[model samples]
Target: MYTPAAFRQDDLGELHRQILACRLATVVSQGPSGLQASHLPLLLEPGEGQFGTLYGHFARTNPQWRDLAEGAEALVIFQGPEAYISPSWYPAKAEHGKVVPTWNYIAVHAQGRAEVFEDGKRLLQLVSRLSDHHEAGRAQPWAVNEAPREYLDAMLRAIVGFALPIEHLQGKWKLGQNRSAADQAGVRAGLAASLDPRDRELAARISADHSAEAAP
Candidate 1:
């Protein structure tokens, strides 16, 4: 995460909020062979010293976790909306025509120890919490036990639950914070004109960052 001071987000609460918004993340680990990564829907435990405690599971047959992490440290990347910013959007292009394309996005990287194991009860708790958190709005909300008992049990056996207690966290909110106000305004307008929903969403975040900065 090569975040300049302007793009750096030091607020832990905001970082956690963004992480929760994007529940799924990529967990990377290193081992004797080399580096390995797995994409998993992780649950964060938020509190004091809780910024880094993440819980997730992978298929037991997925050797990536076992092969790469023997309780070694890992990095979990929680990504936010992202979009492309055309150089043409910058007002500077009209003056010096020296503007170049850039990307606007938000992401959080959490480094911590990887506890790779399957705890059945812990897995059940995690899945139940995930279900409640994500499916809270459904008319007929989904529950973990909607499946047959035997089937669910066997299915559970196929997966291994794990946690990564974050030792450190870094966040990058590259919403053109380094740009001049005029360029930022142009980017906002350009992104608002884009068709991609992601572009709009990322642009909104960038806008919010600017708004917060302007507040007394």
Candidate 2:
């Protein structure tokens, strides 16, 4: 991803946080047919590496995984909060007209080779773990067994488990980083003033980042 120095996020911890918050990702790969992309709820296992491996399963009937080489290698894109930045948010726009509309967002790139595991036990374990991870704080936590056994087994059979052994990591945070502090504040203020809940959330995050950066 093309990122200016101000908008670039090299801090591993922050990048990993963004990746974890992103429940879904775009998994892209090159195939004989052409570039293929699949949307999947990816799990990021953080550890010592460029980035921890990503885990997700594909439907067995999905042809995208059919031609893929076994044993891990592909690009997974994890995207965090994103929003359109209106030029109206800029304080300097009225004076010199130096600004243009832009977007603010966070994204992480992970590349690795994937190992396809089809064992029934492994698949069951993977699903159970995933369920726990997502339902940890729920009032009434749901498990795979909440459904009938035959249905669950049939569902599992239709999918294939896989793990990407991560090789590279790239992250960018474009929360108006290229702008001056005053301009960034203006953007954040505008975002906060808006009725959109997502905008308010992003503004809070950008404000927190700014505060952290400005600390002595």
Q: Tell me, by TM-score, which candidate is best.
A: 1
What residue runs in model 2 are displaced by over 4 Å at the alpha carbon? 48-50, 70-72, 208-216
- What TM-score number comes out for model 2? 0.90
TM-score of 1: 0.91
Q: Give model 2 RMSD, 1 decimal.
A: 3.1
State the lDDT of candidate 2 residue by residue for 99-213, as single tens digits: 7888888888888777787888889888888888899999999998798999888988999988886788888888876677767888889889989888887887786457323
User: Relative to the unseen true structure, what is the C-alpha lDDT of residue 6 in candidate 1, on a scale of 0 to 100?
Assistant: 73
Compute the lDDT for candidate 1. 0.81
CA lDDT, every model vs. true structure: 0.81, 0.79
Cα displacement (Å) at residue 58, model 1: 1.0
